[model samples]
Target: MFDYSEIRQVTSRDNPLVKQYIKLRDQKKYRIELGLFVLEGARLISDAISEGLRIEYAFVTEQAANKYPDTVAGLMKASIIGTYLIPSSLGDVLSATQGSQGLYCCAHTLDKISAADKMNTVGKYLVLDNLQDPGNIGTIIRAADAVGIDGIFLCGCCDIYNPKTVRSTMGSMFRVPLVDDMDYESVISLLHACGIMTFASVVDADARDIRRVHFSGGSAVVIGNEGNGLTERDASLCDQEITIKMKGNINSLNAASAASIILWEMTDEE
Candidate 1:
């Protein structure tokens, strides 16, 4: 096992793993090619270990190394691990965030959901309709896991492997099977062909209150963009539109909040 604590502190800006982490953070293609995604902070690293992901590397400050010694020990066994004693200046160089938690992991990106997995969705499947915000996307993913949604379908949405999205997931990103970057038309066609009842989240007209929408076996729910809401084509594709009743002054809920509400409703709570 590599010495998690004894590894020489690296300060150079050009260290290979440091450069790779930065690239993975900034570019989409590096993440795709390496089959790796980044997870930050102590909580997410703990969660990834619990999920059995093969962590490829971890970059940590001394504080995080001490705080998560056992986790560092485990990751060191199979991974090329490095630690740095980061000053505030160096932290800014390494971290995307102002308040750096001082630790992060790179692990394999999740596998695409296969036909067998698609066929096995006997309950709720969350769908994205070109939803662009990574934070919202990540929160919805975590919510889906909490409510035991069967899988997530990312059609015409932002990349699930985006580091911001991954961080937003808070580790639930590893547990959920995510299918990404599909044609909205083909996705609708496939779901219909497979006999799944689809509910598109929309604002008005011919939509049932989410509370009243009955989700039996194998239902798919679509959540759309942060600003414009679901596209006309996406709304038209569903069997019906489902809306959360809001009596307050807010015209609409945030996409993540809306998705959580809808996923809770879709859960087979019997």
Candidate 2:
């Protein structure tokens, strides 16, 4: 039970917090500089709390605070600073999506582990090489979390904190371990040193069928860009090249779909 009396109301769009939320929502640089990210809706805020993320501030509309009392209570419990009540109209103005839920929060960014630290652990990993789509990145993160992937390695991928990506993750972002912005050579070295075999997902006829590949011990499956697939250098760095077999003229799967299929195969062996 939370004391609703403690919640402060913000009536002006020009309020510093409101202005800050708008900036954090739209600017990646601001997010990076501040070491914070914005999450929307009670569902995501609840997920962040469940994961024990350090929430800095919570902003809710008067209607939402009253309508979703339990959620507001949870946010209050999780918010280290305080919970704020904004007008519903202001929530609409601040939202990135249609039909805003009128619940939002700012939380500290999850700390990323170094490649060396992450690679030392024994488990399956998903590697994204220069993947550009925020939806694909988020979907892959969700899939990885679902299948119990040990970690995700992002090399030249889109910002994981992008609002679209964060929304698409649907809360899985907080549950999974992420390693971002590593170079290929460093990643390959670390993986090999830790006895983790790297498998490149490719569409070429010569690539081995994913069905036949045996996933044992530590392993990583690399998913490339949406449009270009893997670069020659990246593909060559992988210990093996594997492909999902398809019927008819279908030669490719979307990066996220491809990741899901490969993850299923890899995890099924465990």
Candidate 3:
């Protein structure tokens, strides 16, 4: 699919491109500045490609080429600026995960939903407020996709493009529509303008029980941070406050867990 002679070899860890990849992986600021992010694993790269994200650069270890031959062949067909063949040992050193897949690549950030264009006026949506845990963020993204959420608004959350978060999504990130770095007021305003009902998922005992509430219209459930939950002002801004009715005295849940339950209830056709 591509010229074998065109593939470059990087024998030294000191190679400029190697350093650049490492920086993109390690530094969020650098990723933002370069308009690029690094990803590891063959399936993840394939997922990105399937989602129409371009591969700018790729690094493949010899072992990776041998094991994932079909993937390598497909990668050859990709419109990449540079491709490097590295040793397995170096791949191990550069790999973020304990067991390296030996295939890695860099791609520009995916385009996301923005205020410039009004989002869908119908379908379920998720709003994450100040969620700090990358794992939680990624898991929520996966859950949102699984439950068929129309879009996700990430407000004051961790960088969704963080390598760990990206890996945790298990390729779901490529499927789910996302709006990052949004604030509460903007999210509320946008949803209201679109005629979507906004429900704040909170721990308040007096809040309506989520299971009993019928979401008959285009709706959004606002999930809060891992530690503090939502501020009173944010919750009050929503049309209504809802809570999961837990057994016994359990009053709170993990951010991702809460979101999944609320999302399921919100979208439940039964």
Among all candidates shown, the one with the greatest TM-score: 2
Using lDDT as the measure, name the better of candidate 2 and candidate 3: 2
Give the clashing residue pairs of candidate 3, or none. none
TM-scores, in order shown?
Answer: 0.90, 0.96, 0.94
lDDT of 3 by residue, 1-270 (tens): 333575678878898878888898899899889988988998888888778887887889877887887776666667477778888878876788989899988888887566538577777889999999988999999988888888889888989989889998988999998888677798899899999899999998899999888888789899888999999999999999999988887878999889888878877873
Regions more than 4 Å wrong, model 1 = 1-6, 80-89
Every model: Cα RMSD to truth: 2.6, 1.6, 2.1
Q: Model 2: per-residue lDDT, tens digit, 43-124?
A: 8888888889999888898778877788888888888888898888889878989987889998999976776755545689
lDDT of 1 by residue, 1-270 (tens): 334445556677787877887888888888878888777777877778778877887766766667777766665654655444444455567676668777777788766667444565465688888889988999999998898777888877777878788888988878877778567777777787788899989887457888887788778988888899988877888888888888868778999989888888888563
Error of 2 at 178 (Å): 0.3
Candidate 3: regions farther than 4 A off: 1-6, 116-118
Selected candidate, larger lDDT, 1 vs 2: 2
Indicate the TM-score of model 3: 0.94
- List the lowest-lDDT window of 10 residues for candidate 2: 113-122
Would you list the C-alpha lDDT of every candidate in the order shown? Answer: 0.77, 0.88, 0.85
Clashing pairs in 2: none
Compared with the true structure, the alpha-carbon lDDT of candidate 3 equals 0.85
Give the local distance difference test score of model 2.
0.88
